[model samples]
Target: MNFLYPGFLFALLAIAIPIVIHLFNFRKFKKVYFSNVQFLKEAKEQNSSRDKLQHLLVLACRILAVMFLVFAFARPYIPLETGADPDKGNLISVYIDNSYSMETVNKEGNLLDEAKRKAKEIANAYQLNDQFQLLTNDFEGKHQRKLNKEAFIQMLEELKISPASRTMQQVVNRLQQEGDSRKNHLVYLLSDFQQNFVGTEKIKSDSSIRYSFISLKANALPNIAVDSVWSLSPVHQPKQAEQLVVQLHNYGAEDAADIPLKLTINQQQKAISNLNVPAGKSVKDTLSFGGLEKGWQKGVLSIKDFPITFDDELNFSFRVNSEMKVLTISGDPTQQFLKSLFAADPYFKLREMAEANINYSTFPEYSLIVLNGLKQPSSGLAQQLKSYVQNGGSLVIFPDLDAGAAVYTPFLTALSLPVVQELKTGKPVSSSIELKDPLFKDVFDQIPANMDLPIVNRYFSYLERNTAGKESILQLPLSQSLFARYPAGAGKIYLSASTLRPEDGNLSRHPVFVPLLFKVAFSSAKEQPMYYTAGKDDLLEQQKTSVSANQSLVLKSTDGTEIIPEIRQTPGKTLLYIADQLKKPGFYDLKRTDSVLAVLAFNDNRRESDMRYARDQNLKDLFAGQQISVHNSEKDALSLNIEAKNSSIELWKLCLILAVVFLAIEILLIRFFNKTKNIQKP
Candidate 1:
């Protein structure tokens, strides 16, 4: 036990005043004439003994009353913890969870409102001069500094539900960064403590910092969320058919039936359907739509979910190009197979160039580049093409089979393709095609037992040292790769063994040539993601763009709000770092001055959709070795518990109550005892 104000103990000397009064007899006795002196003497003896006992009891009560009153002024309490003297000032950090899940309601009302109230109570429990820090999911820069009691309460009132969500370890790391080492640290986290919030990993904490977890409860709600949406086609063309896969999740115990799903593009209804989702499981459905114009298309996939609607709607954006550019650099300009194939469709803009007159600077302008029969490929061209392919540009290589091994060795090895080992002059027929590959998964409607595969009169066999990422699209009789695809960094390489010359092979004239090249060209569009999570994705990648010293890119929303993101230039791409700049779930246009460069969509993180909270034991297990305590908001007195853990268990009120009871006892002994003695004498 210790006293908060030990100097008040000097007032305990007042107890001696009662002792002095008892010792000094200041009352005078009145004598009366009485008959029967002997009987009066016996009565006087018994009454004297009773009078002494009453006087002694009165003195004892007076002493105890004075002592307890002094103790109450001193303010004694039992210390709970040994570290950190209560005499010194304290630094308190309180984290209030204002995420979307906190919008849940309980018997006491909204959880966010209750959390704010609890935060204010915690602030009031501390001393006036003590410094306090208020933290929330937003993690704003202004919340890093400490504030006084008045300012803390004012800030608490200004908090609102935010789209940002953070895990328990992340919150603790932030608090640890803002703690003052000089003062004792007390950290309080008030949240619903969802299982997702307390991630699977164990929490690392400082032993010196005391942590308190106050778990809030709410009424259970059943929810079905549109988990995700993705496009089946990599490239989008104007007035072409498209398909999108939408995944829905049921987070309740009971299954949901006939949930209406809707798709809208550019504010017009494109497709609609009904779905049935099983309990605690996910279901995927495909929506087919077409007739989109040539520009940026803003798409919204929505479902009608009640009570919890934040994760019901998903926003996405994509571009439908009017034409696809194809660049071809061939050693023989007379080859007209590729030219005739693209000329049949105006959607493909083909530009032909000789190997000696190729412009390396305009490589990024084309989606696909074809190197047709480059007899003696230069090392500089190989290096440039390698960089272009690694930065998400697609390439097709039709090697000049007559060229020596030394000429094509460096080029093939630079692009991580198999090198040409030997040239064979035998007629080998292509045995089979990989119908199950993603390239030809939907291209064939039916397959015959004996398919008329391509025939090769003369070809070059490759020396494949590593087959990690090699996928044989067209195979020869002896399991040899005639046409294969290899994944290099972020792009793909399609390698063919024969050239377009009639003496080489008839693959250029085969029926499978058109669709194979079309699929490869379509897959080269560098499809940016349909959407990005707001707080999770910080970097946005785009094809390289030219920006002058005076020009900058701006991201503008529909409300006219704009932000200039940090721009970083790499070899074949431009990276825009919009760290935490996007908070709302909608479409934002990335523009250079007045012209829109691209449209980007952002959505809230769906981890909060689970709506399942972590148990107290789970939280304890996460921070097993740390000095942590868990309290339920519905059961514990948060302020008193915090106070008791921070400082001590107070005894001043108990001391005051005992003082009043002693004073009442002293009054009874003085008045009632004297009346009884007088009655016995009569």
Candidate 2:
């Protein structure tokens, strides 16, 4: 229908030259053999016609050869049916859904193995040089894997189901960018087809895309899991030992049968609690480990039998500093709030003595100094408090709200606090705080109405203007009281500006009262103890430090006896645990020779049960509604969250082979036809 080179058309006009020669009549022949002359003369006209026709056949062959040569140079390709955007090439992308739903058990098998089998089959079907990239939900830095058949299959074999979760929105976005299906993209998704991964409407794709689903397995396994667990050192006593509470949820719809759960601490079995958790509910289990030493502690909770596990066991660890010593030097006998709120908790020690009776040199051992309404401190007291704060001590003040302007100006100013102004505000409004202050960040969401929390009932004076750096909080409803404060370099300080008494409506009686104070005035200032067991996120920061790329370090205990740390640095300054062989709970002596550099503790959070596979379609939940596919089925196995893509060799290479084979056939046919004709002539 089309000609690439129209110039070849001129060859037809050249055929006319033969016609012109014939019409001119320029030929003559001599008579030889009189007997044939009669036949020759009669056939002459017919022979002339036949000769011209023979010449035309040869011309037609030459014209056709030239036309084919030009057509090959132009190069043509026919378009195929339209669909998702034409893939970068002829890529049929298969996104396997290895989510937890694949964990279901049937007579055939689990869905994950089925997905893997299908991937291998697909990989085998594709050419040996095609490209493929696999995608999964458990994404780390290296999430993409593009390989030919063998390597791609190997990677799929290495994939294991993960307890971690991901979303379908993420999977779809990644697949669109990473898949190599440029030509005929056959997007195959194999999955259990959980409710979370299916959609009512067809997803939008470019012209050449088609989707196929392989619905595999489903099982309604009843599972109860310890979904989450949190352990917080009380804001009030950061260094003290306390109980850990775990939250358990039965993901199933009905009441959970009584399950026996055990708690283990440092290899010490604590308690075995059996309780029936109501269906679709959560229950909190508390584990109390008594009198733990300062540093890291780890605990574990295990249930004997469970259908689904990914979340059945939990790991929790926390660090505790040394005991908190508070030196409360106060002349006022009304130390009722401090005496009752802290010392009575039995976790803290209050060395309460009159201000004049205290020894100044003993300040180094205390974690906090409570200056209760003491307007002036001796120069020695000032020096002691100053040094204590420099070493990270907590300080709390009960300033005299009624004191005169110059009453404690010099002492306060030394801590970067402003001088007070007398008669600045006559009547301060009784109101709630405008905003929950950071010192009170924990209680910000816990505001309760109708709880008659006292306003800072009264203020005799106000801090001088422009003295606000970090020293003010809780603005007055009518601008009077400096309700709370934290002066720099003086450690953490909270000033009530009013007395804690019932006549002031006793706001301290509320549940938010003590915790807020503890978090603000002391929580953030907790100091690291001399020993620490390594945690999930642990690091050491030092200046100008080095060891032969690999070397050991040591640490000593209080008496300079225990030397711990039998570690040799590998490559970086960081060390990671590659195996589960954990050290027993005890003080460790680290050493390189007799020189002691640090003391350490060894403790591990036990892994109660080895069951890791999730029994649900968490992968579908993770990806939201991405299509997933699976092939071979296993009766039972953990859910696989990472789906592998089908891989095959390059299509262009196959196309080249076809062209080569066709050329060989064309040459063989020409040779055979000529040879056969010669044989027939014989």
Candidate 3:
């Protein structure tokens, strides 16, 4: 038998009080009661023997009762495992989930606050000198080192809710990375155990590490959230109406009726709608707004929901460009067809330049770069175009009739594209349009199946190869690829077999020429989504006007915190690598020289908003082969049942029962002895 608190054994000395009392009684015996000596002596002797026997039995019962009571107070417990040692210190790690989901309020108050309290309790349950580690969703630098119990509790007290969300597997992996692995380690995970983020399937039982799950659950109350936001128009135009769609989900038992939603742009209320969301269902509502100024437009979609408010408002940041910039590079300056095609369009800002005078440094600024009538491509120009097309710029290539396949094959191979085999010139081949393509969608009122296709008198026949992401937008009469599109990193490349000159083909004057060219320019000008999820490794792309090589880009949040992210500079674009430094979600600005270059919005991980909890059985199933346990934080932390070699089974309850039994025997003996005295009265 062992005692959790061996110091309580001092209470066993209390038994001596009863023993001292039994040994020293001062009451005098009455001597003149029995006058008749002979008969009284015989009967008194019999009663005296019985009285002595009863007195000894009662004394023994009293001693046993006192001993049992002392043992109960001492809290004796048997060790479940003989090899378990109490002297060895343990390496304890406590993970307090401080995600936004922990903001839920129950009878015990806020779940995060309750988790912090339980974390302190777990720390107190261990010895003061034990090495401890505290982890949270922030995964800060201090979490990488172990601390004493005092420091661990101090760090635990400083924890606050964070926007970052990590799966259970991630938490375990982090513990394994930073925790002390030398000693016996016990990990306590205090969380609401949201099923979407917990990821039970990924948890495996480890013999070296024991886990205790402390789940904090709130009463099932109705929660509604603006689950997500999208738009009908992928490209935001200056004067065009943008139809925004917001999805509202009700994660409750009752239906939500007449939920008011509002849309605000640049801090001005733009549209409002009332939505009805069915129980355990999602409803999408559409709001239309137009006439946004040409610049960065900050938008917000908000809905009122009780208790859970982190996901109440969705922030949107998007750019509205006034015109599409098209840069046309021509080998033959006299080719007026290329210049005339885009000059009259108010939506296009066209700049034509000769091939020799083309500035490679300015390539990324244009939405589309047209390589018009180039007979032979230079290696230097090909290298510049490769980088341009990969960093979200669009390119259109027109092969010259005089240039051989050898001229363009090397450049095409560098971009993972098929090489042009030979030039074919014969009867004019008509073009077949792909109306279902996004570039052609809504372009024509109705597309005729047998419409007069563009005539191609000369075209390059491309070699056939099994390459992915090669799609034909326009096909020749024999199903040969005349114009095809290939995705290059975040951008695209369009390959045309024929030039736009009159002798090459009549395609320059075809009805499809204007819309086709306009689509290519608009496609490259599409803005990236304004918001990004933190810890998700999303790239932030910003347009660069003019920056020196030594200039640095810094991202600053609304709270005045600044971070230097990985910056990559292209011709007209700058890419920032948001690699895990930004944890909180809010409005952040990419700044250079104290000027706001671009504004970005970040959102908290939405997986926790679902409010689905993992059951105890799910954790058990996940840790099936390991010595693990699950516990509710509502219960006392000291009562945690761990199956280890030195698992303690408290015997205080048994001691209390034995103490009662002994006292009861003492009372029953007193009553029986008194009855015998009454019967023996002569």
Q: In TM-score terms, which candidate is top?
A: 1
Residue 408's lDDT in candidate 3 = 80
> Each candidate's lDDT (Cα)?
0.87, 0.52, 0.79
lDDT of 3 by residue, 1-682 (tens): 7665677677767777767766786668887566567767677777877877777788888878877777787778776432334445577888988888888889999998898888877778776767888889888888878899889888877888888888888888888777554566778898888888767474753566777888898777678887788877756779889898889889878999998999999889999999999999999988999988888888888888887788888887887777878898888888887678788777678898887787889887788999888766787888888888877789998877677788888867776678888889888888887778888877889767678878888888888685588888888866688788998876899999888888878888887888887788778874767688876646877764466788878889879989888877764467788677887777788788799878888877778788889998888887777767788777877666644312455678888898899889989998876455422344
C-alpha RMSD in Å of predicted model 3 compared with the true structure: 5.8
- Estimate candidate 1's alpha-carbon lDDT, on a 0 to 1 scale: 0.87
**Which 10-residue window in model 1 sums to the lowest lDDT?**
636-645
TM-score of 1: 0.88
**What does the lDDT come to for candidate 2?**
0.52
Q: List residue ranges in candidate 2 displaced over 4 A.
A: 1-101, 138-145, 172-216, 231-243, 285-295, 319-322, 327-395, 400-458, 461-493, 499-682
Candidate 2 lDDT tens digits, 405-448: 46656666565555555534343345455354655554556666
- My TM-score estimates for the predictions, one after another, are 0.88, 0.52, 0.79
The segments of candidate 1 whose C-alpha lies over 4 angstroms from its true place after superposition are 7-66, 81-84, 124-127, 414-418, 427-436, 446-452, 455-457, 464-472, 475-480, 625-629, 636-647, 663-682
Please give the range of 10 consecutive residues that has the lowest summed lDDT in model 2.
673-682
Candidate structures ordered by TM-score, highest first: 1, 3, 2
